[model samples]
Target: MKPHDVNSTVHEPSWQIFLIFLRLGLTSFGGPVAHLGYFREEFVIRRRWLSEKRYADLVALCQFLPGPASSQVGMALGLTRGGYPGVFAAWCGFTLPSALLLIAFALGLSEWGEALPDGLLDGLKIAAVAVVAQAVWSMGGNLCPDAQRVSIMVVAACLVLLVNTPLSQVGVIITAAIIGTLLFKPAMDAPHEALPFTLSRRAGAFWLALFALLLLGLPVLAGVFESQGLALVDAFYRSGSLVFGGGHVVLPLLQAEVVPTGWVDRETFLAGYGAAQAVPGPLFTFAGFLGAAMNPAPSGWAGGMIALLAIFLPSFLLIAGALPFWEALRSQPRIQSALMGINAAVVGLLLAALYDPVWTSAIHGPADFALALLALTALSSWKLPAWLVVLGCGGIGIML
Candidate 1:
């Protein structure tokens, strides 16, 4: 289809876009992959906002860039339907429900967490073990199908565990990308239909440049000013910028950033992550939970909103930046190969995380191991909803 053919589709008002996504935000449970399924149902199949090919291409572009893939797709669809206004409208609609829910959770946890039953929070932490294990299992199967990729995954896990620093994580990703570019020769798929959006390459470049500027400049500004807000922004922004896989992959980065620095305790961090699985919308909203739960000055609704915006800002910027050049980039063999290696490396990172904070902190005894195992079975074998599994674990925790 030609670009103008797509441009000629009926444009929607910003409120209409918000309402549609609001319904989705409330109803769309599950993780990034499930959210994409919900989006496809709502937009491509139901509303006919864009063709299947166009939606697939858009998904590809978002996946290629860092940040939440489903949220990025929502932003792109909103931009297609209602211009820039639709971007914020869609983001607010889809994001706010869960972000608010998580923030409330944080506030409540702070107020009454001690009054709660003994193993309730432990159950939540155990739920994290299952959820993250599921992520690692599924991602490894898909991304590291070959011997070469499996080797890369193992080496990446080893390196991250040995170095055990945020900077090392970044270096590992870069190294994996280089190794992918040189080693793997991916089979190029047939050319996809061009994206219907009419964003200019110049505008795309501007957005891309802005993403880089914030990523690099935020830390320097934070260091110079020594402000907690700036430091929070810098940490969350960098986490959002560097995350290549999905929300689950952000665990180690966030734990490294907040836990060691004493912004939040390891136990609270795991509990919040466990609670995050129950909420609808993007898992990145866990940032809101972490922000609100921080021991620092910004530790309330104010901090939650800041962290939510900082983490998701990259998704918006990246989607805007890459949409124009997606057609050329997606067709390249080297880019495809690099993405494979990067994805495999991400799986490794998650594996390391599962061992450290998620497992070491959560599983303390035989009962803990059994509970996590049960949760994993419910998730992978029974194919139950995550919220259901999480609640079940919590209830069992109370009993145990």
Candidate 2:
């Protein structure tokens, strides 16, 4: 099917896009992998905003880039659906809920934190395991159909597990692309479903240039001016720009940036992180908490907003800049073959993530495993909404 045929026949207004994503923002729990599952269900399966292949392609692209993969995908979806306005709307809708919650936690709301049962957060983590498992199972089926692709997926997963670093993930992707180029061949006349991006190459180049300029100039500007705000931007921007795997991989980088500098105390940082897990948006929004909790000036809501914007800005610029060029290149037969490998590798990466942080942290005993299975059944078999399932799991966790 053509790309346009797969998407909504009518272009949605930015407000409508915001509303759609706001619902997602309020409900999407787990982490980045689970977020992808939620997005696939909403856009690909429920709303028919894009085809399965197109969504996978977008995932592959975002995985290759730095910053939060899920948020970048959200931004690209918004861009595709309603142009630039939609991009901002989607980001705000999906991000603000968690960002605000974290900021509140930083600004003394954390004192009341013990009100919730301890099981609630544990339940949420268990639900995330189910969500990520669902994503891996479904995407693995679609993207790794052939033996060559399956082999690529297995090897990629093994490599990611063994190496377990942000740069290692990038290496896996690059290696997958090379292997795909060698192993698969596509017909020259294969049908290409062009992404519905209104951005021109010239505009894309401009965005890319801006991204590079900021990446190079921000630290120098921070050092020269010695402004706390500039330094905050520099720290956060660099953290966002350098992170490859996103999600939890950002933690060490952020800790390094904030802790030793004495911007936030270690206890406050750890507390905000715990609070962040309870919220329902991108983990990158932890930047909001750190900013608000900073000992220096520009702390509070103002600081939170600054850190939030600075960290996510790269994702905006990178997606905007890369899409036009990426779209054109992906239309080629050779590139399509490479993407097949890359997509399979992406599935492998998800699989590895599912095993490590999602599964290891959540599944402590038989009861925890049973809860995850029940959540999975609710998601896959009963066709219950993810938000409902997550809540149910949390309740079950309390009981268990």
Candidate 3:
């Protein structure tokens, strides 16, 4: 929907947007990095929910903040179009499909066969490589347009590889936002997502209340309700609320939540996590993976569903509530500097994440490295479809 369409634009009703994101939630792939590429394709480049610049600002902001960057970005993207409720719908839609699949898959891990159907997982991974490569290039073009900005990315990349920092992703982007604002502050006359003031404000408040209720009252409610499902939900939701970087951070949090409890074994958790990296949407989908796979009380697909929703709900609320405020705030010189520093720091964070988790997990041998290089080449130069590459790679993976 066009921005001017009061009825249809980004402010799309919660239910309506739920469906759109639902499809995307299921299909988006390549992890956090790849998810950005998919998001640009669906929302910025194709759907025109917001302008490229606006989307960049939103992305940069989320990257700098301490949270799941992609999921936060998704929530912010929806907010840009529709406000608080828009954020709610986008998250639900984006989160649901994958959560459901992962939860279901998790429940029957033993029965899931030695491997995925020929070429499926491989294809997804290849597609992911392509998608991330594309995002790297595209973001480079838009964000690193200036020589100075380019320097920031290059330096940030080095920091990530060199420092071996644990949670420096948040630091990288925050640093960039600050630098950007200080050195090259821009005017704020640029286009913005149209918004409805009163409704948006009210919706924002509602989201906050919902989040607070879940956080404070949930434990008590769970104990009374005799629902370990509530405990899982609380755990996941708290994880979502506390993390300071992207989805990978969820690993330690989730491990702490489930492992000591003897729910899923180490192997199962690792395997599920590795597999999750290949799926689309948020890394938090791992909630589904564990929720179903573990045989905890009330665990199964049902627990998986509850866990998935609980974790993502707060993101939707916080993002949407902040959207209206961000439009004006981003234009401020102070905010701009902060954003510049933040974005630069985000580059560093991405660099770190790419190495520690994404690269190490996926590329095991020379052959795997070669395949990854090939996938990157396809993404960077050929513009081949992500799905096709992923399919081809999955075939190779099973065989290898």
Candidate 4:
């Protein structure tokens, strides 16, 4: 990225910048974690928007926060790289395809919720176990390479697993930050993975406020119209906004909302989740499966569109709301300390997540354990591309 006096350089045109995000949204494959790799490849490695260290800092911050880390990172990257519109493009591009797919899935599932009883979805759950376990192994070693950070990871894992609290995530991150600052640890911040532009503090707050208002008000407006659109909006918005872990974590919440409404069924819901793991980009696209599957009160494609749009809207709004203000918050020393701790906690939380729901639910027996071992070895030793591992394993899953 060409350097400019923050005040003097003309920003990239919004449409052109939007195209970059759109391209990322369309082409970036895998779920949120994989998406992060893809994002680094594009914006940081390819575009050079910021050094790798800066990008890591941002990733750590988002990981600590409550929303979708990948989407938030993407939008924050955009806001820094371009501006408000940049954030918009990054979000829209990232969210749309999966949303469209989930809506379609929803349409079909609405009529077919109870067709099967076997744990076909079990395969995906198992695969998720492998993926996250691998993620924990891979990230744990790399991110928490040092002894202090390792200690932070341990404390975080115990807190979440033993005590059972989300604050554990916050605690570990804050702890790591204090340690990192005092020790001047995590010495390698990497280098510029991307470049950045700053927004006025006022502009940042404005975008966030606007997003919050829409989030609160849109459903109300939709209620006024007596349209089903509000339900879809609330579901997606809440899924994108409230969940902290990522696509996998977001699943249960999304299912609960759609399933109880009698919108989509259990079998189909699992099917979409399974198929989503196999698909590229954000797992949130499970929405696309759900959307396509839905049958609306009014009927026809309108329902599908509503479901898809509603599900994805929150991700976009969140990006808009969060990205603009990130720089100011990240710059403060204490806040930075807090985020560092939070990042470590996020890793710990991820660790706990891998064991209980993921491994236990996924690894049924020796065969499943063997497969997971294979995936971990493939990830760690063979160092194959993520997509290759996913596709090959997915093929094996279907066969098994």
Candidate 5:
């Protein structure tokens, strides 16, 4: 996009930006990859808000960051289009619908408790297996291009499966980065000029520092004050702060936090997770569900809002921290090489996720296996929208 297109007040009003993303928030589904498709359709192909190349570049930068990839992309678009207000509007529009839906689901679950039907939740879990499997396949193809990268993916997957700990994801990513640095060498190339409309370095540094402060300070505050709200914030914030690959990768981290603590039961946690797949917007909205469903004082609207904000706060800060430096960072051959390995490992992480909670929990019988195959076909072959596949699977599950 031309500089004037974003810089001029009349060119892209904040309300217009909000409305566009709001529509996406309601309709876009299938997870992060599909969200990208919807974004390209709205911003690039239809509105001409940005060029394909520019959007692709933004996507690359967001992928390298440790947050919700699609939400970060939307936020970055808003930041470029209308500054701070645009960022708020874009996030509000894209996130609120699903956040509200999941929160409502949490409330219903709280009220009904065990009285609700299990069939729908079961179907959703089965559908999630297909959804995550498809994501793993697509991401693996994109990230693991050669034999070496494939090896990285395999090793990462095997290692995580073996270790099977909360810290395993971080370890795999770090190990992959080191191996990548040692094994993969990129050809030297001249650096390009910095892109226009980049955020200031000062802003980046401030956000980075603030992120670190909250990450370190929140736990201390929670302990010192003994505030349940603060404790929830610390836990969710840490989960958001530490996530690398986004989406399903957030699952294990969240499971570790709420399940063992008795904040949320395992069945409810798994059910909410499956239901999150059917919703539009970021999968991180699952935090909202868990917040409302928690068996504590924080289990209400206030809790949902707090969890939502805390989980997403790290994304905003990380994006702010990274965007200003992205121009310089993207030009580095070694960083790019390291990202390649990390990306591959991310696919492996998803692969491991698809097996345990997603696959093992959902597929209990031959009939369930058949339904899962149907869901996969609908998603991968028939090209059905994810929401429809989820609904169809749920219906079929109820019938069975």
Candidate 6:
């Protein structure tokens, strides 16, 4: 899968792309960082869907956007491969497994609360630590080779670790862009080919407009109709729209919206959250669980569907809105430099996440530490497939 083969010559069937993403949806665990590992291997390395430079650029684009970064990246990759239908296929394949599992949990979640063995889940988390460490190492080598960029990566990691908030992510990326602009002036002057836009800029503008209109109008409609479904839409949509820094960062906004409004009780909410950790897709799929488990009429599959769509809709719209202009926006030398900085900062963000939620929560004892090292060795050196490593870790965890 060479870079040139993907852009102009190669044509992967939508079904083939869907199946690949579906496998990823079912098998990918360990959060966004781990998902990138799986994607880089499957798409960039194996399939050659895009070049490493293009993939990195796509990642850098998603980092600054306010949606599930992994999902958005998958969708954008899909769109690049096969246009609009490909976009839907990519999202569906990647999102469905966890959405269905969480929805099932929502409907009958109380009957068997937290049924997944805690040890097995812990093993998955430990596997995540190793996976993320690998991602940081690989991406750091590619994105932060020089001392100055390495410094940027370190500071970004430090800032996120210290502040541990979405605002901090925004700050770091912004600061990186400013620094990148100044520091990368030399690199920007180098000749570079422009990337082709997948869709018209007018189409992109329309999507952005629609996103804004819905962001503003949905709440008012919810109030006027006084409808639970509409309110659910409004709440989840706002959660998707407002939150920056995907993954765990979206959790608090969601907690605030549903728990306070009595859409879901605290116990049910926490249980679903726990379940979400062990699932194989984006953490945002917790929306599906919440929707399916909500009190009153919205507590069923339909509700779950609504929530899933609401939470993910913003991501689709943003991706649709952004990708068309990306080539033009990024072609500027200053913008290129800034993106370089932001790319380095993204590696730092992944590092911070790896340490906190991934490492701190998983590596609790010497046994856990040993297991993580084993998993890391398997992945990095032994070259075991990621899914196999995940399964092996779970088996080991059960034994422990």
Best by TM-score: 1
lDDT of each: 0.91, 0.80, 0.64, 0.62, 0.83, 0.78
Candidate 4, 63-139: lDDT as tens digits: 75556678778777666755556666766777766556555545544566456334445555565666666667666
What TM-score, over all chains together, does every model reach?
Answer: 0.97, 0.66, 0.64, 0.65, 0.90, 0.67
Q: Whole-model lDDT for model 6 versus the true structure? A: 0.78
Model 2, 112-136: lDDT tens digits are: 5467676866777787777667767
Steric clash pairs (candidate 6):
1-48
Please give, for residues 144-164, the per-residue lDDT of candidate 6 as tens digits: 989999999899889877776
Best by lDDT: 1
Which portions of model 1 miss their true places by more than 4 Å?
1-9
Q: Is candidate 2 or candidate 6 better by lDDT?
A: 2
| Root-mean-square deviation of every model | 2.5, 6.8, 6.7, 6.3, 3.4, 6.7
Candidate 4, residue 393: Cα displacement in angstroms equals 4.2
Angstrom error at residue 361, model 5: 2.2
Clashes of 6: 1
lDDT of 1 by residue, 1-400 (tens): 2234223245788899999999999988999999999999999899888889888888888888988899999998988987778889999999999999999999999999889999999999999999999999999998899999999999999998888889999999999999999999988776677777667777788889999999999999999999999999999999999899887899988988999899999999999999999989999999999999999979899999999999999888898888778877888888988988899998999999999889999999999999999999999999999999999999999999
Which regions in candidate 4 have their CA more than 4 angstroms from the true location?
1-19, 30-66, 76-86, 105-120, 143-196, 210-239, 242-271, 287-328, 384-394
Residue lDDT tens for model 3, 335-357? 65555554544444454445544
The order by descending TM-score is: 1, 5, 6, 2, 4, 3
The lDDT-based order of candidates, best leading, equals 1, 5, 2, 6, 3, 4
Model 5 alpha-carbon drift over 4 Å, by segment: 1-11, 113-115, 186-196, 223-226
Instruction: Tell me how far the alpha carbon of residue 323 in candidate 3 is from the true structure, in angstroms, after superposition.
Output: 3.8
List residue ranges in candidate 6 displaced over 4 A. 1-10, 111-197, 331-400
Query: How well is each residue in 1-400 modelled by candidate 5, as lDDT tens digits?
Result: 2333223222368899899899999988878887899999988899777677778888878888888999999988888778778888999999999999999999998888578655877888888888888888887887788999999888887887677665677788888888888777777645343333676677788889999999999989999999988999999998888776668778877876788689988667877887887788899999999999889888889899999999999998898788878887887878978877788887887787778667878899998899989889988999998878888887887787
Give the poorly placed runs of model 2, Cα more than 4 Å off.
1-10, 109-192, 328-400
